[model samples]
Target: MDIYVLVGIVIFLALAFDFINGFHDTANAIATSVSTRALSPRVAIIVASIMNFVGAMLFTGVAKTIGGKVADPAKLEHGVEIVIASLLSAILWNLVTWWFGIPSSSSHALIGSLAGAVVSAEGFGGINYSGFTDIIKGLIFSPLIAFTIGFIVMWLFKQIFAKSSPHQINKGFRTGQIITAAFQSFTHGTNDAQKAMGIITFALVAANLQSTLDVPWWVKVAAASSMALGTSIGGWKIIKTMGTKIFKIEPINGFAADITSASVILTATLTKLPVSTTHVITSAILGVGSAKRFSAVKWGLAGRIVISWIITIPVTAIIAALIYRVIALFM
Candidate 1:
């Protein structure tokens, strides 16, 4: 097969994975706003879709990280095969989680797949320990940071509005929720789509389709567009989980959690860390739920989600490794 043709296939698959990531995680950004009747389902998805595209244009720091820093590309004997395996692993995992109405991290799936492919291609020597360790720091800290900030912001809002009339507080927070939700969606685009863009660009280079690290303008447009279109489809089942399962989200709590998730994700993106928007926002929601009372959170269900998070990386990694091995045997 021609190298350019092979690279093109990998890029398309990567964009497809990005599309799944956006649609699968749509519930993360708009669930509360929809549940609280701040926006109708149609309006919420349309608004989120626009913000998602705009957000994709905001930065490329994380894209650079994924394309250039995580693993040494030279070590992979079959770069195109690795690309296919990694993207397929992410896509399959995203579908599985979506089917079960659980919000898992697409970001972690890609990282794990790439790492697994690198190891399979050429032992641990292919891994960039410093870059890999930095990503690990982000994976561990992002959700914890988002949870703390969400809790504090929600608590403060409750304290300040304690004396306000319910009508006034509700109106104020309804307006605030729109702004925070938009911010979260924007952050989502900036971080999530870039991961796909990076992988596609990396594949091009690996297949000798591109001579440099720079991503083609067409790749950016396609990646961003796929994510935006996917967001428009929405994820209703997971929306129910986030909006109602965690706790009864008032407008004030919704606003706080959105702001907190936005802040953490934006900061992580600037630092070029491939962090999970799903993990960050879900952690914030759980924190808000726990703030009211421990019992307010469905601990059993939350525990299950945590277990899913724990398994995502290894499961996807093994899947990707198997994919590469199979492809090598046939191709």
Candidate 2:
């Protein structure tokens, strides 16, 4: 295929990945609020969609990191093809996980896939080790940070509100959950949606269509719009898993989890690092659930979720590597 045509396909695939990410991961933002009856599913999806678009428009630092950190697009002869393979692998993993209602990390899938594709095209020496390790560190520690903060936050809430009547507390916190959910959705936009933008920017640079990793305005708009539309659809199965299955989340618990995870996500965005909203949010829920009652948390399910997180990188890496090899055959 011509370089121009391949670049076009890469852009299309990048946007498609963003769209899937919207629904696949947006559930984490609104699940707690919906579960606690703080917001109807319809209202939650609408709010998430609008906030995601707004959030996506306000950041470009992380997009730049993704474009150049793993490998220099300017140096790779097969950079565009690598992007195509990475995107396809990521998208396939996303769909499969969403179908099973698993709350896996989209960030890890994209990062791992991109790295694997780079290695396929340019060998292990191709990776920017320092940059790649930093991204990995960000991903690995974010959930742990969220868990610790969530535990502390929820514990504080419990102490502060202990004397209050349960009914009144639930009533007030239900309203509070609405704001936290919106904030969560907004932070999600700031981070998760930008992965697609970065991939598209990477393609542009690789194709020599642009000179720098700065995201183009049209690229930002297209990625934002694609994600917002996907957010509107909502991921019902994952919502169920995140909301009702994790634990019986009351309004107070939901509020704590939402606010904690949102702050963590926004912090990562400001630092120009990509973190998995899925892992952060889910870990927050687990931490909050632990604080609520250690015995109450379904440890079995939490263990299963942790397993998925651990495997996402290696699984997506192998998939993308194989994809690049197959694509290489024709070129």
Candidate 3:
């Protein structure tokens, strides 16, 4: 394939991955608000779409980290092809998880796929151990942090509202959920939307069209637009899983979960680290549920979700390595 043609294919696939990510993770942002009747589905999707775009347009640090941190795009012999395999594999995982209504991590799929493809193409030496380990650390610790903070936040809310009427507290918190939902969606954009941008930029550098990791203007617009459009579609199945299955999310519980997850995601973005919005959001809900009443949480379902998270990296990695090997036959 001509280099230009290959690059074009990579760009297309990257944007497609971004689009899938938007809807796959959409539930992370609005499920709580919608479940609590703080915002209707239609209004929630619209607000999430707009906020996602705005947040995507405003951040590039995460993109830079993704482009260079896992593996050096410019140093590989077939970096563009590695990126193509990574995108395709990640997209496949996202779709499969979405179909099953599982709240899996698109971030994990992408990062793991990219790392696997790089290793397949260049051996273990292909990876920048320092950078890659840092990324992994961020992914590993973020959900734990979100869970802890979620517990504390919900604990505070419970104490503060103990003397108040339950109905009155819920009525007030329902209104507050709208703002937190928007912020959650915006933070989602800050982290998730950048994954595709990074993948595309990785391809550009590998193709010799760019020398630096700085994202181009057109790339930003295209990625932001793709994510916004996807967010508008909504993912009702995943929304059901996230909003209701884990536990009963009253307005106050929803508020605490949203605020906790959003803050964690935004902090990760600021540090130029990519965290799984799915994990953070779900963990926050779990933490809040525990604080509300430990037994009320469906521990069996939560255990299954955790199992999926544990396997995503290795499964996607093996899948991407196989994909790269298949592509190598043509090369």
Candidate 4:
């Protein structure tokens, strides 16, 4: 097959992955608002879709990082094939976890798959240890930071509103969630949509169609549009898990979680690092729940979620590696 043809296929697959990511991670943006009844599902989806599109178009630093960090696309003989395998493996893992209503990280899936596919094609020596470790550090620590920030934010909320009537406070935060949710969705767009753009640009670079890590405008538009469309479709299953599984979310709690996670995510975007919005938002919710009352959280469910987080990277990496070997048979 022509490398150009393969590049075309990669483009399609990258958009498809973005679309899947849109719905798959959509829950991260709107779950709290929907759970708290701050916004109806229909309205929430609309808001998220628009904000995600806008956010996706506004940045490309993370895209550049993703394009060049895992392994230099220019250095590989079968770079396009590796991209195909990586996308296939990432998409497969995403769908599997989505089917089970697990809020797994699309970021991890893509990063792991890219690493696995690269190693499969060029051996461990091909991997960019410094860049890979920097990305991994962002992914691992962002959630912990989000959790701590969420706890402090909730604690502050409690302290400031302690004298207020509980009913009135809840009512006010319920309305405030509208703003936070929109902001959350925007930040989600900025970070999550860029991953697909990065992969597509990586493919372009690998195929010798481009010279730099710069993301083309067309790439950004395609990625952002795909993500917005997927967000419009909504992911009700994950919504249920994020909204009410780990803890029963109230308006105040939702507000705290949304703000904390959004801040962490947006910070990562600005720093050109890819972090898991799912992990950050989920951990933020757990922290808020804990601040509300440690005993009130369902620790079993939180444990299950953490387990999923722990396993996603290794599992997806192995899957991508095997898939790459199978792809090599035909190539």
Candidate 5:
């Protein structure tokens, strides 16, 4: 393949992953709204997609952090092979999770695949300890933070309106759900689209195609456009799992969960940490459910989700390793 054509193909694959990221995780931002009838499923997805696009345009720091600060691109001497392996691994995992109707993290899958391919390509020396450490910390802390916030918010709402009528409370929270869901969608764009942008920018650098660490405008446009398009398509299968399987979502609980997830995600973005919105929201929902009653949380389903989370990185990494080896033959 021509060098230019190879680059284009890599870029397109990255964008495809971004689109899948948006669609696959649409449940994180809008599932509760759709379930509570606060927004029809179609309308909710449209609104979420718009906010996701806007969020992507507003946050560029994440792309910089991943592309430049993470594993160095120069180490990826086999740039095309690296890109192909990473994206194929992530896409495969995304499809697997989606088919199972489990909400796993696309962000984590991408990172895991990238790490695996980089390690395979150049051995341990190619890895960036600093970047790896930050992501590890995020993987642990983001969900905990979201869970705490979710618990506190739900508890506070209950305490404050101890005597309020159920109907009145539900009405107020239904309105609140719109705002919080939008926040989640915005934060989703800010954090997630950057993963795709980072991959594309890193590819450019590795291929000696770009001059600086700065990602080109075209990269951002492509990443954001693909993610938004994916969000518009929505993920109804996972939506059922998130909106109803873990817990029966009421307006109040949904509002609290969305608020908690959104706040944690946006804060992580500002710090340039790429945490999974799926993990955060899922944890938040669990926290809210636990607050109602320990049994209300459906530990079985939660366990399944956690198992998926644990497997996502390693499973995708293994797949990425295989992909790298396969592509090496072509290269």
Candidate 6:
């Protein structure tokens, strides 16, 4: 196949992955607000869709990191094919997880798929160990941080509102959740959507159409638009899992979780690190639940979610590796 055609296929696959990610992970952003009745499902989705677009357009640092970190596209002879395999694998994993209402990390799927595809094509040395480890560290530690911050924030809120009546406190926080939800969605776009941009930019470099990781304007617009459209579709299955299954979230719990997760995501974006919004948001909710009342949280459900997170990378890596092998047979 011509390099141009392969690049086109990669572009298509990257966009499709972005679109899937929007619904798969963006559900975490609006789940709390929708569950608490802070915003209706229709209104929340619309808000998240618009904010995700705006946030996606505002940054490129994380894109550059993703493009260059896992492996150097410039060094691989079949980089475009590797990227195609990665995107396809990631998309497959995202869809499977979404169907089962698992709040898995799209970041882990994409990053793991990229690494696996690269290794499949060029062996383990193809990986940039320092860069890959750094990215992994970010992914691992960010959730722990989000969990801690969520606990502290919730604890503070509890103390401050200790004298307030439950009904009055929830009423006030329900309104506050709207702003937090929008912020959460916006931060989600800034980080999550950039993975697709990074993958596309990686293909561009691999195809010799670009000399650098700097994202083109058209790439940004296309990625942002695809994610926004996907967000509009809404992931109701995930919404149910995130909003109500993990714990019974009151308006106050929702507010704290949204604020904590959004803060962690925004910080990661600014630092040019790709963190999983799914992990952070879910961890935040769990932390808040623990702070509110440890027994109230369904630990078994939370454990299952954690197990999903733990396995995402290894499973996606194997999937992408197999995909690359299959693609290589054709080439």
Clashes of 1: 0
TM-score, cand. 4: 0.99
The lDDT per prediction is 0.85, 0.96, 0.95, 0.95, 0.88, 0.96
For each candidate in turn, the TM-score is: 0.97, 0.99, 0.99, 0.99, 0.98, 0.99
Estimate the Cα RMSD of every predicted model relative to the unseen true structure.
Answer: 1.3, 0.5, 0.5, 0.6, 1.0, 0.5
Worst 10 residues of 2 by lDDT: 60-69
Off by over 4 Å in 3: none
Query: Model 4, range 210-329, lDDT digits (tens) per residue?
Result: 989899999999999999999999999999999988888999999999999999999999999999999999999999998999998999988998999998888988999999999899
Indicate whether candidate 3 or candidate 5 has the larger lDDT. Answer: 3
Single out the weakest 10-residue window by summed lDDT for candidate 3: 190-199
Model 5 C-alpha lDDT per residue in residues 188-209, reported as the tens digit of each score: 9999999899888888888898
Off by over 4 Å in 2: none
User: At residue 296, what lDDT does model 1 achieve?
Assistant: 76
Clashing pairs in 1: none
Quantify how close model 1 is to the true structure by its C-alpha RMSD in Å.
1.3
Greater TM-score among 1 and 5 belongs to 5
Please state the error at residue 240 of candidate 6 in Å: 0.5
lDDT of 1: 0.85
lDDT of 1 by residue, 259-313 (tens): 8899999999988887999999999988877775668789888888888888998
Report the lDDT tens digits of candidate 6 across residue range 42-113: 999999999999999999989999999999999999999999999999999999999999999999999999
How many Å off is the CA of 164 in candidate 6? 0.6
**Candidate 2 lDDT by residue in tens digits, 1-331:** 8889999999899999999999999899999999999999999999999999999999998899899999999999999999999999999999999999999999999999999999989999999999999999999999999999999999999999999999999999999999999999999999998999999999999999999999999999999999999999999999999999889999999999999999999999999999999999999999999999999898999999999999999999999999999999999
Candidate 2: residue 270 Cα off by (Å): 0.4
The deviation in Å at residue 12 for candidate 5 is 1.0
